[model samples]
Target: MTFPIRTPDDLHIEKRDLKFGRDDAPPRWWHSNDPGRTAFFNALSSTFPVGEKFFMTAVRHYRDGTAEPLRSQIDDFLYQESMHSREHVVFNRQAQDAGFDIASAEDRARRTIAWAKRRSPIQQLAGTCALEHFTATLAHDALANPEHLGGASNEARRMWQWHAIEEIEHKAVAFDTYLHATRTMTPFRRWLKRSVVMILTSLRFHYVIFRNTADLLRQDGRNDWATWKGLLAWLYGRKGLMRAMGLSIFTYIKPGFHPWEIDDRSLLKDALRLLEAGKPKEMAA
Candidate 1:
């Protein structure tokens, strides 16, 4: 299928108005207004800086003529990801203001960037594709598990939900670009490398979570039991986050799977219509 990449005409990235503890936003079940939530936010905050670097990397790759079709999407992708990183950074600041130490989280993120830089360009591209797939699965899970996320304030939920929808919307762009750039790679090798990257990256991410959670718990005078229980509960929740991730990964095995193919375009159309409608300011907000 020919993927005609189109950039949205009206993409804005204003700084969001979000307060940390004073906001009406309730924490996620895993966070439960606990110290763990702070840790989670801190970890998430680290993504923005990494995202900026990734954006530059995409631009560099695009300029080098690696993937012509995706060249059209590069500017849009950069805009979207830049905004995502900014909002997440704001969210992280809120968590820090609410008592989460974010220094270590930043350090971990820097280390991740350093590691990525060490890889060859093709390896880095493959890694990017794998990470994109991982994020797509996460976006789906976030939207599906409203119960877990429902406690967040209306505005916060809307922000996250919008982000999730867009993540799904652009899911295949990077993968398709990678395929086009690296056509010589055998399918078996591509799948194998993707699987390996997923396993390794997941482990690294979980390790950061574990460390951050432990730090938060210790600071709050909570024992290991509380931290372990929260983590376990999140993993074993009814929505089965891990299971969804595994299932989503299998989409790579399908020969012609693309994000646009799986996405509910009608929902996107409806959202666009709503966005275009002249609703009351508060109601839309």
Candidate 2:
């Protein structure tokens, strides 16, 4: 459930055409009816639409010279990321209706991505590789542990489920692109660069996600000690998300690490089921 270490030479990358029906907005604490958990997911969504563009840019930088199947996969990756960004924009607007600071969150996300673009191309790809892992780990967990989305509104849950599925589908593209683009660097140097960036990326994400979560929760009047205590428990308690995600993050340090090495593609069954359930009748095959 934790590690996502698997790849196939003939991996089929398909864009899922699914729609979440949101005729009416859900409560502000849409996640399981808990402000803290809701804040966590909202904070993540706030960043996803804007931040994923940087991911596409990093992959595109090195994808031009890739061989046949990977070239096609990279194209699919670009398309999926564009779709993901757009979907999250819709999701964020819903959060805005709930009084969350969408403008401030967008500002922070853009500033973060802008800073990342200023780094060397290799570094930018390294950061993207790291982020892909972060998201893929989360996606794997959501599929493996249904409780993660237990309290979510149907529409919101469907969007995240769909997003998670696509994240897992193309989990290795950025890393593969990184290797293709960094032929000039020695293996050891490349490892060092990626390892260092993953560490920093982890820290920066932790800080920003929670900072945004706290801010959003405050706006929702979830400022009590009981709320913070319950939220912290949900994050760090046994089988909490951060704990589940840690192994995947640390695995990047292993020699000859490939994302597919920790294969959890079996989890895709659940994701596929969700996709099937969410497809518009017109788009249903």
lDDT tens digits by residue: candidate 2, 126-211: 99999999999888888778888878987788788888888888998888777777767788998898899999999888888887
lDDT of 2 at 112: 89
Off by over 4 Å in 2: 1-6, 278-285
C-alpha lDDT of all candidate models, in order: 0.58, 0.82
- Top TM-score model: 2
lDDT of each residue in 88-139, candidate 1, tens digit only: 7666666565565667777777787688778777667666776677667777
Give candidate 1 regions above 4 Å deviation: 1-34, 55-60, 63-69, 250-261, 264-285
Worst 10 residues of 1 by lDDT: 12-21
TM-score of each: 0.76, 0.92
- Candidate 2 pairs with clashing backbones: 5-259, 5-260, 5-261, 5-262, 5-263, 6-260, 6-261, 32-151
Please give the lDDT score for candidate 2. Answer: 0.82
Cα RMSD (angstroms) for every candidate in the order listed: 5.0, 3.7
